[model samples]
Target: MEPIDDLVGRLGRWSAGRGPLFLLLATRLRQLIDDGVLPPGALLPPDRRLAGALAVGRTTVVAAYDTLRQEGRVVRRQGSGTRVAPAVPTPGPRVAETSNPLFLHLLDAPDDVILLSCAAPLGPPPELTRAYATMTLPADDLGYHPAGLGALRTAIAGRYRSQGVATVPEQILVTTGAQQALSLLTRLLVAPGDGVLLEAPTYPGALDLFREASAGLLPVAVGPDGLDVDAALRLMERHRPVLAYVVSCYQNPTGAVLPPLKGRRLVERAAALGVPLVDDEVLADLTLPGGDGPAPSPLAAYEGGSGEGGVIGVGSLSKVVWGGLRVGWIRGPQPLIARLARLKAVHDLGSDVPAQLAAVRLLAGFAPVQAARTRALRTGHDHLRAELGRLLPSWTCPPAAGGQTLWVRLPYGDGVSFAQVALRHGVAVLPGRTMDALGGSGPYLRLHFLLGPEALTEAVRRLARAWEEYEPQPAAPHAVAPGAVPAIVV
Candidate 1:
């Protein structure tokens, strides 16, 4: 095989007309493979060497590989690497309709790029070195452990108690990540046909996880205030949902924080309607400098003493600490925590032990992490908000009063198209559809203002380019032949 690094260097600086670098590469490659530009049994470039030459993370190359594998355009060998897969026959649809539309990479790193695509920004807390260096996993015989260790539970409980939550050590069960916490919760409570209330434009991964569990999603429109309680009440009363997952503080994509009263009221109403509330406090670590402290103790407090009313809280170190920490926990009824623990046992046995210790040690210093993030967000958002205001002044962007992102409506109102064009400009952005409840949108783009200073600026610039390129393009009907209708969206 040709040196893949050399190969990566040799490929022309490709245009990101439809999506970002990796996806554009994957899309073009998929088309070539289908057209036999690279025949079956032909080897594609290796990932590591390709990533090395591109100066992008290995994860980016991995995502390109994943997209190809998912599209059935490539089959990869472990030691031998990837090759063009044999093509299968398809429907005899018309020529125009037959062009394969590829799925973009869900998690891709870009080129010569400041990546604003990923949600995670900060690195491990400073103490992480001492935390890991001095900490020790047990010397016991190796085997599957139950849920989290007693030490972590105690530490987590103690941490929450400082916030006046008074969560019992026994009530907390650590999981690999908040995503798993959510998945386990769904497995325990939601069966097919069960209704789950999700804040519209909520966390996309959480939405995807819930959908995979086969639960029906009822979207409650979100605003700067928070989840619309009145609309949510209507949905709950009508659907009597089995679960209503929420992010009261710093709602994802929107950057909206729930007022103290709103958080309390959400708990009251959900309890009154017999719906269990899953509070996603993953982004609640208030880092947008000078923001208010956590809204009056979380909804879980209503069930605090005896653990009634069914308000479960989920948290993770991923956002505030580091995504690679792979550590998160839940606070609710000790009995319910026990139940999820059983569900967890079948999933990954237990949260990573080493990572968990690092987390416990890091929690004591959350103040510094929170302080650093607050400073960054405050500084970044000011520059970012100003840029948006000066550049695309027509749209309204809710001041990221305190979160990792800025949610803004585009002046022209087709965020999905602009996102596509941005990829072509060497930027990756998530469209509102990814955050949409039913895969549609409200002209929103979740702009992560928490990126490094240069990255944030470049990201906004790409947004401008994406908007410029996309707005004047004719609609699908005019772009393609009349009978060649645009494919149905999933």
Candidate 2:
């Protein structure tokens, strides 16, 4: 049992946020539970006693206790009062693999629900259409190049060279998409119970993959300028992680671009630690109109020389061009690439030949495609931000210069529970808890701005209605000053 004064001291400034009194208290209690400050079987103060201590109405403490009870974090008995619940055992790999909201949305896409859960381009760009039109096949070829087609490999290596990372065709391996690239690397590097370091509040797909592999996830904080290199290095020395994954350019949910200096330090430290680092750059090319020129060169570029044996770069056409094209590649050392190719052969023999041919042409003429993408993304991003501000002003939505999604912080209630209310109102937004390995992003949501202006307006309107219904209105609403809420850098 925790002492009431001690618990009160631990929950410093719990009422600083703009949420309902109950929700703010509940959020603070939830954090304590998650941080193990209030361990399982620890007794909580009585509702009346806590209300007296905090100087709030007894109803507020009751509601807060009820919230934690509903989440299975606490147990309340008729005579004994409330206590923290025992930790549940981790689910099996099969069950954990498909537990993400992204997969759930895909499996059961209800009609009429505006899906802001998945963040992929709507369709192929005009350049992709033209590439398919000009795609050619050789009559003499069997097309079983498991390491990717020769022309496509060459094109990818050439592209790397242009970006200041020296590369050769042998260092590139084509996969179905960036997801497959991540899967292959996880299979090659991580064993059951091995530590795999990554960013907190990262891409949900990657979290699903790591959980499926049964790897112990070591999460480092990511900020506006990108990953915390010093903290990552400390974790590496402490945990000796087998593999480290980072979305260096235009990070998935947060849209943070890693500075070159941090990228250099990270790869250098990882290399010294003999940790295989996978730099996921799928969203790198989707730089918006107001972004700082282009995204910094791939993390591999910072390693100098051939960039072999240190950082592995993964890129895809899915984000910059179209998801249907299904073209992605991995750039690594020749030996690693060769080993991955053999592993890939057992899966699908090789990627689709026609798609690779088209990718080659697309890469040859990518400047125009990039220009078109950035223009559309800029419009969508601005429109979504404007609509969110106009309709749901209390939600803190930081401006993302690039990438498809916005990481939003709700003013009051947690995202997981509120998302259900949002869904009932005909919209599906991803809760930030799904993206977090430690389940700490309770008040955040990942909302993609891929929809056009009209659709975005509708989505925000539905979300506003959902918020109004879900949150209890106080007699006098508190006004949050502009920038009062800190941005949640994933």
Give me the candidate number with maximum lDDT: 2
Compared with the true structure, what per-residue lDDT tens digits does model 1 show for residues 1-490?
Answer: 5345323422333332434667756654553343232446668777877777777777877888899898777888798788877645455521322231212233333345544555775576666767888987778836354568777888888877776676778889898888788878988998755678888778876765665554556767787688888778877886688889988877887877777777777788888888999998887775466555544456676554555457888998877767778888888877888899988887778877888778877876777866776777688888888888876777778676566777777765455666667778877666665565433343566777766667677777877777677778743110111111111111
- lDDT tens digits, residue span 1-490, model 2: 5568757765655776566889878877886565444656779999999999999999999999999999999999999889998766575544423344445567677778998887888989888888778767889999898999999999999999999999999999999998899989988887766778898768877776776565666777777787878878987987698889999987877788888888888888899999989999898888888766878898888888767868999999998888888889999999999999999999999999999999999898899898888888889989999999999999999988788889999986677778778989999888775665544566788998888899999999999999999889332222221111111111
lDDT of 2: 0.81
- C-alpha TM-score for every candidate: 0.73, 0.79
For model 1, the superposed segments whose C-alpha errors exceed 4 Å read 1-108, 112-114, 141-144, 292-296, 438-440, 474-490
Tell me the whole-model lDDT of each prediction, alpha carbons only.
0.68, 0.81
User: Going through the candidates in order, what is the number of backbone clashes in each?
Assistant: 6, 0
Off by over 4 Å in 2: 1-102, 473-490
**What's model 2's lDDT at 307?**
72
